[model samples]
Target chain A: MTLEEVRHLLDAEVLSGHEYMKKEVSKAFSCDLMSDALTSVEDRTLLLTGLVNPHTVRTAEMLDISGVVFVRGKVPDEDTIKLAKENGIVIMITKYTLYVSSGILYSNGLEGASILHN
Target chain B: MITIKLKYQVEKDDFMKAGQASSNLKKVLKQLGINSKIVRKIAIATYEAEMNIIIHSEGGSIDASIDPEKVKIIVRDRGPGIKDIELAMKAGYSTASQKVRELGFGAGMGLPNIKRCCDEFAIRSSFGEYTELSITIYHSGNNTEEGGE
Candidate 1:
């Protein structure tokens, strides 16, 4: 699914990388723990996280993840937003919780990123 | 043989600048025309090592030596080192503080993730003095197969 559709599905607000709304990201990973999230190797996966911090963006940057959705109405501080912009990662905010956001995206035909652990 | 050497200082508890070293190293590898898959592997391993220093040690440095065939990342830190290497290597084991956990790390996956990403991984620690990690990833051939064009 394109990030634009994700935005529409969740009524999310794009805080950065507005131009990337059309970027297709069919796989998503939802996690607050950066290390667990890093276990996945999928590229172009959208991260749905409640952790709003610079490390989140750093994790995405290292893994080549292109987009992040902040769940549970979480909003990142200025530094986090700046880092995401610097790394060219699109950031969005959604009022839904992480589970709901994941469910919404999953039911909409988006798949979960394949994880390395059992 | 052409080689590129890069060094970066990692400060303790410096959450704001924690990823700078790995980020710079990743850029340099990309500019050097390393394969994207290999670069991704190097970036993830280096970043985890860099973050481990920031979140766990007093301070440290990460050194990268890149040649045509492989890249080697050496991470060394002043410590308060790990007392139990076996337990520390466990995937869900972490000694990070609550504050660190709140930062979205500390799920204890750093070292394991690094090992998983690299072709060769070695670690040494002096318990009270310091810890060091050597990570290597090949660009093409396996570890045993060596030749030159």
Candidate 2:
């Protein structure tokens, strides 16, 4: 789905990269562990994470992730948001917990970015 | 042959700057028109190595060299080194502190992940002294093979 659709479906606030909402993301990976995310996430996937830190954005940049959704009403600090913007990654804030957000996205046809190993 | 060499210093416990070297290397690779897949692999491997220095070591330097045939990243640090290389090579073994783990890393996957992403990987260290990693990924035009010794 397009990021625009994701934003609307989750009732999220656009925290950065507002101009790139038209970008389409096929898979979503929800995890707070940056190591697991690094091991699993594919290019252009959406990262749904509760970890609000610069490292989160750094992980997205390293993996070429399309965007990040901050679950559980979590919002990144200024440095984190700035880093996301610099990396051209779209960021959104949502009130839903990680699990609920994943469920909503899954029901809407957004699939998980499956890991080959844990 | 003209090769590009870049050096970056990673500070101890500077989580915010952990991935800068890798990110910069990724940008350079992309600008050089390296294959996206190859670029991604290099980025992942380099980032993992960089994170290791930030989380586990006192400090380190990453030296990256890019040529037409391949890219090589060497990360060296002076710190308390791995005592058991074999066990540390396992997929889920980490000695990162609680603060590092809270950042979503230190899950014992960093080294394994780096090894998986490179065409060649080698590590050497003396306990309580230092650790060093050498990772290389070859560019084979279109069909790139993945493996390392």
Candidate 3:
């Protein structure tokens, strides 16, 4: 789904990269642990996370994630928002908890990124 | 035969600046026209190594060299080194403090994640003294598969 659709599905407010809403993201990965996110090999996916920090943006930058959705009504600080903007990562905020948010997106046809098998 | 070398000093306990070196490296790799897949791998490896220094070391430096064929990153730190290389290499072993864990890291996947993102990975350390990590990723643009431990 395109980021614009994601924003609508979650009732999310765009915090950064407002210009890139037309970008399409097919997969989604939801995790609070940055390490777990790093280990997953998924590109152009959307990251649904509860962790609000600069490193979240860094992780998105490294993995080439298309966008980030901060769930549970978490609002990132200015520095975090600025970093996301600098990295060209679109950021959005929603009131739905992480679990519910993931479910909503999944039910809307967003697939999960395949995990690397051991 | 262009070789670009970049260096950055990582400050201990400085979570705010933890990923700067890796971020810079990623930008440079993109500008150099390396494959996006290869660039992401290099970025993840370098960022993991860089965070290891910032979270565990007294201080350190990250040195990255981009050549036509491969990208190499060397992260060296002066601090408490790993006591068990084998144990530390495990996917879920970590010595990071609670404060570090609060930052959404320290899940013990750092080293393993770095290894997974690189073509070659090596580490050396002296307990309570220093640690060094070397990660290399080829630029052939076809080796982006997730590595098996």
The per-model DockQ list reads: 0.51, 0.54, 0.60
Error of 1 at A71 (Å): 0.5
lDDT score at residue B95, model 3, on the 0-100 scale: 90
Docking class of 2: medium
- Clash number by candidate, in order: 0, 0, 0
Stretches of candidate 1 exceeding 4 Å from the true structure:
B141-149
Q: What does DockQ come to for candidate 2?
A: 0.54
lDDT of 2 by residue, B1-149 (tens): 36999999999988756788999999988778777777888998889989899888999999999887899899999899999999999988888889889988998988888888888999999999999999999985733323210
Query: Candidate 1 iRMS, in Å?
Result: 4.2
iRMSD values, candidates in order: 4.2, 3.8, 3.2
| Runs of candidate 3 exceeding 4 Å displacement | B141-149
Give the per-residue Cα lDDT of candidate 1 at B3.
Answer: 90
Global CA lDDT computed for model 1:
0.88
Worst 10 residues of 2 chain A by lDDT: A36-45
Chain B, per-candidate TM-score: 0.92, 0.92, 0.92
